[model samples]
Target chain A: MSDQTENEESPLAGEAYTLTSEPKLIDGRRVLGVVPGKPSTGESKDLIDEDAVMVWPHLLVRHAVAALAVMLLVLLLALLFDAPLREIANPNLTPNPEKAPWYFAALQELLAHFHPLVAGILVPTGILFGLAALPYLDRNAYLKPRHRKVAITAFTAFLGIWIILTLVGFAFRGPNWGWVWPWNEWYGEL
Target chain B: MKVMDRVRHSMMGRSFFRAPDRVTTRDVAAGHWANFFLHIYPVKMRRKEISFRYSWYLGAISTVLFGSLVASGVYLMFFYVPSPANAYGDIINLETQVAFGQYIRNVHRWSAHLMVLAVSFHMARVFYRGAYKSPREFNWVIGVVLLLLTLLLSFTGYLLPWDQLAYWAVTVGTGMATYVPFIGDRVSEILLGGPAVGASTLIRFYVLHVALLPAVLVVVLAVHLWRWRKDSMLDMERSEP
Candidate 1:
């Protein structure tokens, strides 16, 4: 069927063309006259095929370097700063500020303003479910951010707000969960 | 290179490798396919996909940090016990008495913090790159699971030190759980194994940090990587045309 279409479209349709030698078989198909020009699909398709590369050395080498770099950073950190060890845990005496880990600082900050149910349970659950549902929710098939304005905007806004809240909860808040300059009165713990 | 070639031709190497020497692209691909460690990786990827800007290698960095944690954590576990009386004392003894204990503990601490950062960055990178599209959607979900697991792992390990920071931080962290309408108390009870963060809580968090969560993360991470390898070659962007 493709051959029929090609023959009909060919400029040499009505002209008599002869093979220089006996017709050879290629890939179980009778050899037609070899066209000595670019493929109909164009050069970009071939370039796309060339874009793929073996992962053995190409990717593995990069991964190895990354691994080494991270290891070195960890080592430097370990050497420079000792892991903080405060007084032994005293359950009867609670710390004043009573902060959570840095990662959960955003939720902790939210808890300061909102009800525990809203800030703790509902918000975190909503975020998790929303993240898991993102691909299905935003059905736009475009890969570029410019083509995906809504998703990009929503994510960036969430990211920015979360980061700010985390910084506030981790560093800015002091005793009684009151706002304080981090440099003056540092309450942040590892 | 010559030495590697000679080894490849050796009888022992031939028996071990089960593939021809890496002379051509096909040979390299065959060798990659035959290796157990490389099973998690696709044999080939788009050149752009492998570049530094594409991923910033955050996933790789996170995995390496996990590896560092496992190594350093196991070493620390040898000198410590999970009890109210001994936990803090053990840490003190380990840091002062045992050789390289302080260094190893520091490595574990820093690695845990870095792992959290790397994993979160990985998720954000994946989001901005629109890497969570159709064929890769499930992998993205798996990634979310990983992020949660990373947080859980760090939180659980935080209590193992038995310091004041660990105690109060965990208390504040777990205190939020009681806000859940139903089964809130039950969840907190199950997690602490008692009314409050006591000996029972210490042991519970220890077991979770050292044993259960790591096992689950390993399994989930395996599935995540397997799916990644399977979907690596898919042209999600081009499929529309």
Candidate 2:
């Protein structure tokens, strides 16, 4: 099929640049090399296969480096920061301003301003559906950042909002979940 | 002299991992095929696929972080009990008395956080690269599910320590489930096993955290990897000759 397409695309295939009789293996798959020059009578082939590296050493070495770096970082973190374990649970006594885990802090923040149904259920579900439907919605084959202007802009905005909300929840919320300035004494309630 | 060198190489290789002194075509093919782990990978990859500048290796790092979390979690579990009566005390005993227990807990906590970040960033990386298009779409969806699983795993485990922090944090977190309109109360009740976060909640969270969620994640991850290998890296598709 490819040979037919190549031949059809090239009007002067036999006259301009003849096909090489020799077939070669590329990335373990057999491929026909096209000799793009003056037509040759003899069977001399020029390999036009894309250059690639064996996964064994090339990709494996990088994977090894990544593994080592992650291990070292985790070790350093474990040594430096002990996991937080607060006072034992007491049903009668609640922390002045209870908070969710940091990752959910953004959603908590959203709940502070918007209705829980909208903030917690609707928005998150929308985001997930949006993510899942992205490939189908945007069928453009190009990957360059400039070509995907709208996607890049919208995603960046979403990330910015997420970070801002998380920051507000993490550091700004205080007693009764009121918005407190970071430098204020009420922040100590956290 | 060369024969003596070959003998020395064989002797040294026998002491360690056995391998030929020089790599050949057979060695390259066998390197992937003969090894259980390496067999997941294709023998040869496009130069662009291995380029760090493109991927920054976020997905691989996320997998490593997840592995670390599981290892550290299991180690910590040896010193932990899920019951509300002993959960906090067990954590304290583990930290102060058990050797490397604090380290294990810390690694598990930090790695969990890192895995969340890594997985989220990996999704972003795939999105920006437009790797989710065409044949790769389902794998992208699988990745999204994995991301959700990572978050749920982290959230469920958040209640394991049974500290005031864990109890109340979970209270606030699960309270969000009550906003689902009609089924909201039922969802919250089901999660807590009642109207509140109590012993039932802790045990439920513990079971889901350690056994159920991790098992699901592993099964889904296998699918993710199978698709990744079968489809090859997206760079192969994007790169021009």
Candidate 3:
């Protein structure tokens, strides 16, 4: 969510009650926070109030660092290799039976038989359009697996099909663009 | 009532098994430091709701795969020359000659396919969650543009091989482009460089696959991310602290 949403959601909460969320020393000396929700001994810093929020900075930092590390490694590699660029493209040799990179070969294979609008343009567009509209679709507030069975199952089925089709496409379809209709080929990728 | 029972006894009933240690009342409480940002929405009405389901992870995971593509793609670039004569040979050499060349190509190829799936799945997850409610409408549009960019990247990269597959695939793909009215032919001409996918086409795709498209994508992605941050993260239960 964005900051705008935050303001909209918290119009009254911030003003509902005044808590010494942040305590400061008075008389320019030191002000001990009289936290209404604190451990009686004050030795343990555990918070006890529903009004208090606890955040794990380390967790967010971990995510941020992981993202940064991966991206940096990619950038460095990119600087080193410069990706392969082929020679002059030949149009006369049309039907060059242009297969997509091995990765996209399946879709290219699908496009090989299906129309571009359907395989290349239409279906993919629909999927994206569908994604952007998700917030309005599944609004159930349950985070547990039991509450999200449909979501989990649907995602798994989708990935399963894609990966399975890809492996199957790679296996049955030889380098020459051949294909097979067997489930065994869905076992793995090269 | 105990918080555990409160959670376990909700309309959907709490999921006791999902990170039980971390699901303390504080995790869902209002106003906390560090993670105050997550509480962008009111919590009382949240009712144990998830943000966009675990499906939301698809987007983050897709971003990871995209990162992998950019890496391996760059590595493949080192030995690849944009000339038609050398393109195929270079690919062969990368496979048979260069160190880790085969691995790089394999990873690049696989991740490219993976990204396509991830992007599509990510979109699907978003749609399923209806996270596009009220104020978040425009980001959805931005997402659509990003999807187009992803496909365009995939399409343009298809011709970089200069093999039978590259030549024929691009030929068929661009042939469709030529059908557009008005400046269709011109557009195809611009795409192929000199009427067809030749040396010019190779260079065109080279420029596009590497420089042009990435540049555009980066800008758009930055905006998309900025919007996400500005729009508040899609958190479940508006959990803060």
Fnat per model, in the order shown: 0.81, 0.76, 0.17
Listed in order, each prediction's TM-score against the native is: 0.89, 0.82, 0.57
What would the per-residue lDDT of candidate 2 be over residues B1-241, giving only the tens digit for each residue?
Answer: 5674466368675344344332345645754565677766777766776878768899899999989988888898888889999899999999999998888988998899889989988988888887787778889989989999999999999899998888888898898899898999999999999999998999999999999999999999999988988877445444522
Instruction: Name the docking class for model 2.
Output: acceptable
Quality of candidate 1's docking, in CAPRI categories?
Answer: acceptable
User: Could you say which candidate leads in TM-score?
Assistant: 1
Each prediction's DockQ against the real complex: 0.38, 0.37, 0.11
Off by over 4 Å in 3: A1-190, B1-56, B233-241
TM-score of chain A of 3: 0.53
Clashing residue pairs found in predicted model 2: none
Of 1 and 2, the candidate ahead on TM-score is 1
Clashing pairs in 1: none
Worst 10 residues of 3 chain B by lDDT: B43-52
Q: What is the lDDT of residue A29 in candidate 3?
A: 24
Runs in model 2 deviating more than 4 A are A1-50, A183-190, B1-23, B233-241
Backbone clashes under 3 angstroms, per model = 0, 0, 47
